[model samples]
Target: MACRSCRRQLALLMRQTTTATEFQNVAILRQFVATRPPRLDQRRNFGSTPRQLGVRDIIAQVFKNSAEPYRVVQATEHIYKACAREASYTISAKDRTAGTIPKTAEGEDLGEGTTMWHNEFKLPPTFSTWSQVTMLHMYLIFARLRDLDREVARSWQRQLIDHYFFDAEEKMDLVHGISSRGLRHRYLKDLFIQWRGIIAAYDEGVVKGDSVLASAVWRNVYKARDDVDVRALAAIVSWMRLCLKMLDQIPDESLYFQTESVFKWPAKNEFMLVDKPVRELEDALQPTVTSAPAKAPVKVAAKATA
Candidate 1:
């Protein structure tokens, strides 16, 4: 700025010169005020294109985005959604005048659906039964989430149960038609206690053995009914083991995102892999020798009569 101002002043002075001698002398003199050069960027150049992210960097970013505090809830929401869908089953409203539930063709009282669980297993069509069944499924998801990093697993498990209560309370209002807020709140507290017991019982059952797990299922899902089907208890234990194996096969990255794909209900009368013997499990590992190709089916028809 100073140099520009001086240059302007010099020009004016030369223009106003009365004598040619002064203007000639000033023009002849070398420039005293030097012009400053333009500034240049000195930042280091990495490359023309931005550097690509590594596997670790991408993973860190993924974890950071999906597993953070409030964000974790949103990221793992699909897990709860899947659990809720699998666990959700409705009991049809009873016929007020008939004073009995709708019956199946065999004179058995039909449940909303899942004839095996409701009718065959003798589970009642009520809110409590629904809750017990829902909790059983939720525990399966909770167990798999336990395999993740401590904090990450904790977040997922917390949300899993939290979502359960939220849905339960909603059902209490909409489905069960219990409009009293205070009554609903009381029921929710009790349900929360039950959920805690379920987690402990299930974790112990899974760790010890199938018999122990069956007992847990007997108590939890069967509600300790005297006539509870032993086969039903066995079937639950088998399904749980199968679900855990499926969960284990899934990559950690897919734990929360695609976990719904693993929540499959057992087919009626379909032998689960858990119950099948390992060697004969789904005929996966058959005998290889083949009895020496059945001795080439020797032609001994004529020798038989001799």
Candidate 2:
């Protein structure tokens, strides 16, 4: 099918063509273009007449700017399925080599030369990386919301909390035989790294931290900077949806302790220093505490004897 831009342009072309024959010619040209896949030749050339540039050209520009990540979570699922299949293996047999099999004069060997195949799983790094990137994007969006509305911010935070630890634990439980050490030590390790990166990004200006976190943060969040071509909002939405889907696969009570332990909400202010943004938000959402002092200060009397 012609791209949205091409279709829009064709409509305008029909309007511009005054004569019936010209309109027919334009229709034929549009049909011919539609049948062919997009090519450099089909693109508007510098030499093209003013008629070539119209609503289509304007739309192409608008569409280009309107680009956003779409169905990323769904795309991630497809990738996961591909990865799962790629890593799966089954037993099979190999062909017998020459002179390997014990055969009769007719060249039929009865279990003399034998070959076998063993099961194997071929895991791909792409799947893991994609999963991590999607999670990071999800966290970033939540981080952005943390500044906007308190309820929305809280929901996102809860989602991040519920998702990273609780949801993942459940999912990991499905493969019953999978070892805790492997799941905790390896998978959670990577997730923890992503989690820390999210915190670092969100608290870059406000928190007291080393530059190492800053330098490494962006790299961990985006798998390949070049591969991600979407608005930040769209990317996060895709990831959030993916996280929801992942929630279903999670088994009950997998391992939330390790997940929750990775991130700490900023400490609440007791003395009300220059309230930082997070602290301010926290204090507002939090209930106020009214504590009475144990003892009032006693007034000292001036010395009577000089």
TM-score of 2: 0.26
Model 2 RMSD vs true structure: 24.2
Q: Rate the local accuracy (lDDT) of all candidates.
A: 0.64, 0.38
Full-model lDDT, candidate 1? 0.64
| Candidates' RMSD to native | 23.4, 24.2
Q: Which residue pairs clash in candidate 2? A: 170-250, 170-251, 171-249, 171-250, 171-251
Clashes of 1: 0
lDDT of 2 at 276: 52
Which lDDT tens digits does candidate 1 get at residues 1-306? 466335533443343333333443344332221323234554444452112223344445544543354444555456666655543456466542354656543443344645355655567655666778778777887777778888568756765665667668777776656789999999899998998899899989999999999999888877677887666787778778888888888888876566777665652343444355654755765656555454566675655654
lDDT of 2 by residue, 90-164 (tens): 211232333343333333222311111011111122324334443544453444444544643453344344334
TM-scores, each model vs. reference: 0.61, 0.26
